[model samples]
Target: MFTPVHADFFNAPTLELSRNLLGQILVHELPEGVVAGRIVETEAYMGAEDRAAHSFGNRRTKRTEIMFGKPGLVYTYQMHTHTLVNVVAGPEETPRAILIRAVEPVEGIELMRERRGKHMPMKQWTSGPGKLTKAMAINMDYYGHYFTEKPLYIAQGNPVESVSVGPRIGIGNSLDAVHYPYRFWESENPFVSKFR
Candidate 1:
C-alpha cells in the first residue's frame, strides 16, 4: 500500500536528493516478511569530484561501476562484515549516491527486533548505518538492483518538518570536501546515526 517514489526523484542533485530522502520509507520484501522504515538520515557523495566519494577521481572498479549506472538502483557493499546500503543518485553517468544512515522502524518491527536484538534499546536498533541494515535485512544480494521496483524500494511517507545538515561522518582524510554539509537528517530524530 506504499507509493513508490519515481526514479526521476533521485535524478536531481545529490544534496537536494539527500535532504528530500528524509521521511521517505525504505521497504524490503523478504521471504520471511515485508520490512519497512522511514528514512531519517542520509549522506550524499557527489561523483568523482568529492574526495570522499567511492568514484572519487574516476576510481571506478568492478565494485563501483554500478554507482555510475542509472539512478534509483541499490549500491551496496560490505564494510568489514556488515552490509551498507545506498541509493544510486544523480544523472545517469555520474557516480553519486546517498547513504541511508538511519531509519525509524515502520513495519515488521518484531522481525527487526529479532534481527537486531530483542533486548537492545530502540535507538540502537536502527540508529546507525550498519545497525539499520542488519535490522532491515539489507545485504549484498541487493547490489545493483533497481530500487524503484520490488524487493527493495522507496515510498512516499511522512513529510519532514525540518532537517539538520552537517559534514559527512567518519571521513577525516578526504581533504576540504570533508567540510561540505552533505549529511541530512530529520531534526532531533533520535533514530539518526549516533554520529549526527
Candidate 2:
C-alpha cells in the first residue's frame, strides 16, 4: 500500500527536491488499472537564471504558466511526439521544476509492458523521460494536476542508499547551463536512463 506524499513533501528547494525525489514511487491510476514505478532518476531546472530552464529569463506563456504555480503541481509538456512529466518546485512564481527522468516498475508491470509492447525489454520500458511517461500512461491530461491528489500522486518508498549526480542530458544548447551538475539518480539502478 502506498500513502500519498503531502504538499509539504515538495516544499524543499528545487535542487533539494530533485534529489529527494529519488526512490519515491510515482503512481498513476488509469481506468485500465493502477501503474506505479519507483523513481530512479531526476534532473532539476532552475528557474529564470538557468538557461536550460523553460522559464529562463522569466519567459512565461500558456505552457509555462503552471510552473509559476504552487509547489506539487504537475507540469506536463510535449517534446516532439512524446510527452514528458515534471514536478513543480520552488515558491510560487519561481517556475522551478524537477523532471522525472526514469523509474523502476513497481506495480502494474503488465500494464506498463502492454503500453511499451511485450517485445521490448522491461528495462527499456521506463528507462527514460519520454519512455517512462508512455509506459506509465502519463500524458498532457496530467498537466496542472496536483501531485498531492489522487488518480496520480507520489508515494513514499524505500530510501535510496547511494545517489549519483552529473550534468543533465539533451540541452547542450544552453551552453554553461548544460554543464551544471543537476542530474541525480539511484546509483547502479538499471532502470535509470543513463549512468553518470
Candidate 3:
C-alpha cells in the first residue's frame, strides 16, 4: 500500500516544498471514485516580501488566513469559476504556499473523464491547475483541510531525477517578482502545463 506523505514533508520552506513536490502523487478519494495524479509542476509563493503572494506584507484576510496556518493543509481559492489548490507551507504564522501547477493522470482515468465530461487528450487531462482540480474533483470545500487525512492526500511517489525551473505564471501586478524563478517542473514532462 502506498503511504501518504508525512506532514513533515510540507514543514519546510515553500520553495523547497515546491521543487520537491514534482513526481509526488496527489490522491483524491472522492465519493464517486479515487483519482490520482503525478505532480509535474509547482509554483512557490511567500508572504510579505513576495508580492505575488496573497499574504504579501502580512495582509491576512478571511480567505488568506489559512495561508498563515501550519503546514500540510490545503489553501484552496477560486479563480473565476474554477477552484485552484495550494499546499500550505512554512511554520505557523508564516504565510506561504506551493501551488500545484500541473499533474499527469495516474489512476482513475474513467472517473476523471466522467468528471471532466466528454473527452480530452491525455496531455490536457491534468496539465494545468484548473484542469487538474476539475479532473480530481477538488473544490473550495477542501480549503484549510489537513492533507494528512482521508478524502485527499499526497502520497509518496517516484523521485524526480531532474527538473526545470522558471518564473511563475500569471499575476501581472507583481512586477519585480514576476521574474523570480519560483516555478519548478519535471524536465521533459509533456504534462507540465502550457506555461512551461
Q: lDDT, candidate 3, residue 17?
A: 87
Per-structure clash totals for the candidates: 0, 0, 1
What ranges in model 1 sit over 4 Å off?
none
Lowest-lDDT window of 10 residues in candidate 2? 187-196
lDDT by candidate, in order shown: 0.90, 0.94, 0.90
Kindly list the per-residue Cα lDDT of model 2 for residues 1-196, writing each as its tens digit.
Answer: 7899977999999889999999999999889889999999999999899999999999999999999999999999999999999999999999999999999999999999999999999999999999999999898999999998889999988779999999999997999998999999998999989644
Q: What alpha-carbon RMSD in Å does predicted model 1 have with respect to the real structure?
A: 1.1
TM-score of 1: 0.97
User: lDDT value for candidate 1?
Assistant: 0.90
lDDT of 1 by residue, 117-152 (tens): 789987789998898899998989999888788888
TM-score of each: 0.97, 0.98, 0.96
79-155: candidate 3 lDDT, tens digit per residue: 98889999998889999999999999988989988877765777888888999999999999999898878888999
